[model samples]
Target: MGSTMIEKILARSSGSDSVSAGDIVFARPHRILSHDNSAAILGIFEKLGGKKVWASDRIFIALDHAVPPPDEKKAKNHTMIREFVARQGIRHFYEGGTGICHQVLPEYGHVKPGVVIFGSDSHTTTHGAFGAAGIPIGRTETASVWALGETWLKVPESFRIELSGEAPRGVVAKDIILYIIGKVSADGATYKAVEFHGAGVENMDISGRMTICNMAAEMGAKAGMVPFDKVTEEWLSGAGVKEYDPLYPDDDALYEKKMEIDLAGITPQVARPHKVDNVVPVSELEETVIDVALLGTCTNGRLEDLRQAVEILDGRRIKSGVRLLVYPASRKEMQQADKEGLIGKLLQSGAQIAVPACGPCLGAYGGVLAPGENCISTANRNFKGRMGCREDTGVYLASPATVAASALEGRIVSPYI
Candidate 1:
């Protein structure tokens, strides 16, 4: 009979005493997020007859996709965005190389518990790691949020997923989520708020939680969150975030569905080409050869993820048939890796290091696959032509450790050793 955290957050943002699944309410978001797509959104904003944004301070613009401007068109887009930012006096614009929008937004203390945010990118659900509801909206919707500061949302049915038990060694947040998606299927939780609960999620680091939440969209979740806890507090404190009202679900909160997963049963998992939900255990794909290993993205591109990959490589070089591309999610993560000597080791191991941009995660450039080449990547999606413009190429999704291990062997392999 109690409200779920998503319900509560929705109620608070909408200034409503109470809300339930299916209730449409106009909610004012604490922040608005857009990346390179801001170019398109700003155009829509102008088309909507907007002169200035609702609040310059609340808007976050980060140039990530096609960053460093892959072409003259994109370069002009960046130039236009810069001029628009100056004209609108938007205060939170992040230039190219700062990092992915999701990574840098929280680094700047923008994401907080109980706040509501809407980003133009699907991975906006990533912010739910901090116990805030981060929803993805379309470009037109993003433009509307920029102009109106608020948008209407239908409260989604909530599901409670309790994760317990310790995972096997080499198993990580990415593999676990992949396992869940494989079990639940792609559209399993469509338009539903998913709350990650129990010991497993609670024990995970903020980076791990971000990885889990970042992929929630793959399962069609409207929001994916873990309640705020000490881990959350510590990370935010490091980011200089002092005050936030952490919201928790009522003990008897009603859920549309409830399930429990034992992490002990999980293993390094992979999603084969063409779809995120087409997953299987890595053991099943031992002989699968790989031509590339991509080890970074918003999903698994953090200092912890980089460290995981480096730990697997361990003073070894990747095999001949494999070209390894390691992209830091942000400059902060890259700097931390550099400070810890992770970068030097990777270079010595022959892994190619790229900037903190999205980097072919959506095939925006920096690293793209050729026909007949297959890549094992830490990125979230592996849709056809996702990592390359050529549909003849293929992509396989895995954790950082798995990607690195596969790179070392020139084949799809688990991180068991």
Candidate 2:
């Protein structure tokens, strides 16, 4: 009879005492998130016959995803988004070089615990690390929320994934998650609110938790959440969040499914071309050649990831003829790295530090691969054409340490090796 975290949050937003799986509720979100695609969303808002947003203060826009106007087209789109923000009186707008919207939003305290957040990007689930419900919606749904202030949500069944044991040397949150996704396959938790639990999850810093929840969408999960605890509290407090309502599932809450993963057995994992679940241990593919090694994304571009990569590089330049691209997730992260001299270290290691945005992750701009080339990256997905936009080009998903180690070796090598 107890409620899951999603159920409780939805019920509160719906002004109800309780909600169950399969129940439909109209919930008002604490934040409405959109990125560079806001231009399309703005057009939809106008088609809905909207002049002004229902709640300008609740709307947050960012010019990420194709930042720096890769072309005249993207530049024009950015122009429209800026004009739209000014016209609508939206308060939280971040321009290019400001970092990805997810990182910028949290850096500025836009995410608060126990609140519902709906975004136009699938990785909206990243906010769940802070104890919020982050659900991805389409562009039209975004415009509707802008005009109407509320939207419908079908309460999802819950899945509890329990993690145990400490990760071994050179293994990290990314490898652990890759191993889980490989075990469960792509459609494992479709439409379910996946809650992460146990010591393995609790041991991670806020950055690692964000990476876990950000990639939940890869598993077809509606949302992925880590329980709010001291880690969450400390991070939020540092981010200037003074008050929040953190929600936790009841001890006896019912779940549709459960899974357990022991991190001790996990190692550097790689999700091969065309599928994030097409994973195998790095040891299995030591000779896999790579043309590029990417070291950042919203999924793993935080300071922790950058530090780990720098540690592996350890004053060693990457292999000749291989390109190493290092992208920090946000301006804040970029600045911190500069202060700590990590940026200099990476640059000396033959890494090219790009702007703080979704660079090369979506194949929009930055370092796109040539035909028949392969890249080993610290990104979330490895779907076909995800990075290079060509069937012949391939991408391998791995942790920062693995990517760095492979960059030095010019092949898919384990960091531990």
Candidate 3:
């Protein structure tokens, strides 16, 4: 009888008392986000006869996908976006070097509990880690939001996923989510909202929660959320969020499906080349060679991730044949890592620390693999051609620890060893 978190958020956003799955409502989002693709959205907006955005203040723009511009065309796109931002008076614009849009927006406190956000990137669902609803929208839909200030969404059915036991040593949030996705398959939760809770989730920090939420997109989920608890409150408060009305689903809220996972026995997991759901335990794979080891992205590019990598690589160097690339998610994160000497440790370990951006993750630019080469990355997806070389090169997805461990051996290996 009670409403789920997604339902409650939708109800409030639409000025309704209650909403149910399948109910369509026009909701005004707390924020609308766009990144490198904003250039295309701008063109579409103008085509739709849009002169000014409905809410300039609530619109956020960032240049991240093609940082530094891989070519003259991308550079020109950034130029157009810059001109658009200036002319539209959009105050929340972040230029290249600021970081990936997903990481940049939340780090700046743009995401808050109980609010709804729509981002043009699929990974935009990463914001749900803050107990808010972050939905991914297409470019044209984003253009519509820019012109009309509102968009329609069908309240998705809810999936109640309760995590019961603590994760095993050396197993991080990425491993746990990968295990779940392997069980459910890629399309198992299509168009559903997954709400995470229980002892394990309660024990997770914001970074861990963010990792889980970030991968929910791989499960075909509309959104992934953790209830706003003390951890959420503490993170918000630390970010200078003084006021927010956190929302949670009632105990009796209806769920379309439910699952309980005990992480006590879970171990380090990996998603092999070509598909995120093609997952297996790190121990299952044969010792495979790696040409590149990437240590950052929106998924696992936080300070904690860098520190973990530092712990593993401090006294040693990555294999001579392997190229290790470390990219911090944001300028602030990069600065903090530098202040703590983590960056120096990585550099000393023979790792190349790139600027704060989404480099090499989408393979749009930076660190593209050569023919027959493969990379071990802390990124979310591992689909073929995702790393800019589909014909021969491949990508493997794992946690930061595993990435560091494999970098040392120049092969796929578990960090626990």
Candidate 4:
């Protein structure tokens, strides 16, 4: 039987024969990434009679969620995490001011193809963009891996998505993904692996791949992946990947479903409030006004995304009543944008720059939405009350282009025009 891409990678890592979907595999992870959300899991594990981590340095910890902690309790949690990381001897400790775990993992070479990565974060699916098997496990499972150095995985069925036609102007990978989420529903791809392929995917840049893969969890997917190619090789090479090999699914590999997407006439899309699956074209929601226009997150806070925003908002001031918040994904990204004058342009255009954390996205440390306020953001997830509002404040998920356009119009608008 021909092995799927995931099976091949896992088999190699586990030192086993060819494995198939539906089979259970026990494999050592290439990386185990966790953030403050699960850092407390370590303490819980200790309370549950597990003392030391099996391998200290294998764990990667990021203090992003409560970064620059919003209150005293959150600050104590950050302090506890620092003490835990120090006690565990974790070398990849990213203190406050570092980027989100998902964004920094790949950039720092902690995520690569042909390897298994387990994260305590649900969005760890973001690492699959590099052709790696990245899955989010619950706290107990994460702690067990920390103690045992390995974990069991039930192979997931595969879903193949092949894109052929070009995405229309102002449309982005986020739109295509949201469209898929709407079609597939929230749990449509549950316990399944999604593989992105075809010429349209190939035409997309690295950041676009990250954008698609980052939202795989929205479908209740086990993971989402793209085949490693020259682009992957180049990205890995630049990040000091010296002796890595790319892997792909065999021609005869099995998939439970296949979807062919033609983005030829697709317009910029938005995920309406309280549900990521509530997708609509920008033209359909032109009358919806917004109070906040936020541009940045682990999902769409890359350099290219910032550049796109700057290109659209270069000389135009943000519309009255619109408070545009610009946040770079990382300190490096902020510095680069400043050097390139994009930050200056944004500030001059009435955009308030927020610090580089998972701010405003997860409602942890920065920027909480109030009832009756409306925001158009590039961040992932639009669940009701997600941004710290009990009354279900409105949040429209969009790309940088759409966000910049909406900031300039104070309402949903098409950037293509």
Candidate 5:
């Protein structure tokens, strides 16, 4: 058997050939997702004379991007999506405080093990945490899927990133992923499958695994995944998804390439301004003031991530110059945090709690940065001007621990300190 999570899932779903490590297979999609951004593209499909949706049950339309519409432009986008969803009679619609796409899709049980999922958003790969091979497709491809349940794919070469040792203090799966991106460069894993294993990975939870796999696109990977284990078993058990077994790569599983990461030496690092590739150790950056420190994305919005931030800033207040924002990944997570007093602790620490939504991750919603301002975020990308400002605006990507520490200090900070 191949060493690729993608290949294994595809082989089972297709039930035709015994897929090898690097063999490309034509796949039938089990689920397809779209939000406001991609829904607008589907509207164009209407103009192109597409009749009925290929399979309405298979398409999921979410209103995460502009829900509670941040501005007139965003509001218009939401309006377009509402009309489209209603017109298409797409029943699997998530709206009104539904939260981010990645968070909602899995919670709603749209992703099943051994199935192939594709979303219009780049972070669609996040679903791989559930043992599904999910990838992001362009609007054109989304439209095609809307007309036809199948899409073409190239079998990507497989790369194995095996983790060794344990993640050090104040270091998180996010930092580990940033470390990987630093080593591989931003485009190093382009169009490749990444399977993570080792003792370090085994210790991580589903949320942490989701954070790592969600950023696979940042490294230009086709998809990233960790084979389901006890953590996954626990998550699925809660949802009553029984009779499911996770597939692991064989010991001699074929891999096109392999790299081992030592998690013990890792410290808090940040992707500095301009590019996610322009990474530096948090200690290497000078005292740079920040305008915003936002946490809570599909990347780090899970309950444990909030607990870490709460531990770091439980009694301390954020610096006056910095605006610290927190948004839980879902209403369910928010309720749990509130019950556990995490929300109160955050507010007492000078963090502004926003409704369950995407917030500023897309750069179009609440808490965007202005010119000359800097932001420390737990969101996925930090490309120049990615969050609202022109390409010259600065953004830094870091772990929730680092982001929380920096918000208190009003500058970039190494959480280890």
Candidate 6:
């Protein structure tokens, strides 16, 4: 039997000819990612007697979670991180305003195909879009990597998700993934690697693929991946990646489970408040009122996402009572949107554009809702109190287009409508 992508990557990383799903190997990752939590990781590193990182050049840090430091406590944390970076001679550190770590890492050419990347954030899986095995590690684990330069990973069983048929009009990758998660439920793929393939995936762009993989964690997946292909190559090349040998699973690779989805008939989908798997068609919930609409995050804050929202809100204002917040994922993305006048159009539509940051995605700052309020957000996760507001506030997840259309109508409505 052939090895799956995860198996192959693990085998190479561990210098083994072959590895299987339950095999544990100590692998040295090509890159280690950490963000605002670096402060905490630094604390752990100190406790481990870590005077210096195993490899400063291999580590990437970004201050994104609370870009401007919403409070003095966070500001002091940033101060400590800055001092640590300077003392450690870390070359790839990105300060606030650089953008979310997930987006920044790829934009800076730190992520490459067939490489292993470990990050301190759950959305670390987002890097899998480039055909790398991006896994999330806890702060202490990250600290261990800093001290020892390697960590162990038990190769995960693979779940093959084959997507057939082209995505229908108005249905984006977010909708397709949401539908799958709804079917599988939140814990369906626990500790398994979800490998995507087939027509629907092939037809998706890097942004869409990133969106799908970013949310795989919500389904309890250890990682999510799309095979490297011309699309992946084109994206990397554009990002200044000169040469890379992409990796893919063999045609007969063994998989623990397999599933297929046909997207030709799939419509816009929404994950209602409090549960990401509580998905339903937008048409079924069009009458639900919303008090806020958020149009950016690591999940859907790329240029394409902004364009989708722009198409829907170009010359019209959002509903009178609704507040719209838009944020670009990275400084570069924000610049591109500004160059194309998307920001101006969004502002014309009564949308408030915030700095490039995580914003209210983690309830840290930026568009928190009040008790009894309802919000439709492009950010992943709608769990209770996720927006840093009253637990009574409801958060709904959807594609940027769906969010924009809903914002215009002040209620849950399909972009197709």
Query: Each model's RMSD to truth, in Å?
Result: 0.8, 0.9, 0.9, 1.4, 1.9, 0.9
List candidate 5 stretches off by more than 4 Å.
1-3, 20-24, 243-245
Model 1 bad stretches (over 4 Å)? none
Candidate 6 clash pair list: 363-388
TM-score of 4: 0.97
Return the top candidate by lDDT.
1
Per-residue error at 348 for model 2, in Å? 0.2
Error of 4 at 368 (Å): 0.9
Clashes of each: 0, 0, 0, 0, 0, 1
User: How do the residues 354-397 of candidate 2 rate in per-residue lDDT, one tens digit apiece?
Assistant: 99999999888888888889999998878778885685998999
Please report how far candidate 5 places residue 6 from its true position, in Å.
1.7
Question: What are the lDDT figures for the candidates, one per model?
Answer: 0.92, 0.91, 0.91, 0.84, 0.82, 0.92
TM-score of each: 0.99, 0.99, 0.99, 0.97, 0.95, 0.98
For model 4, residues 247-290, the per-residue Cα lDDT tens digits are: 89989888899999888867888889888888888778758989
lDDT of 1 at 256: 93
Q: Cα lDDT of model 1 overall?
A: 0.92
In terms of TM-score, how similar is model 1 to the real structure?
Answer: 0.99
Task: List, residue by residue over 1-417, the lDDT tens digit for candidate 3.
Answer: 999999999898899999999999998899999999999999999999999999889999989989989799999999999999999999899989999898889878899999899999898788888999999999999999999999999999999999998888878888999999998889988899999989999999998899999999999999999989999889888788868898899999999999999999788999998889999999998778999999999999999999888888867989998999998999988999999999888998999998888899988988988989989999998988998888888898999999999999999999987
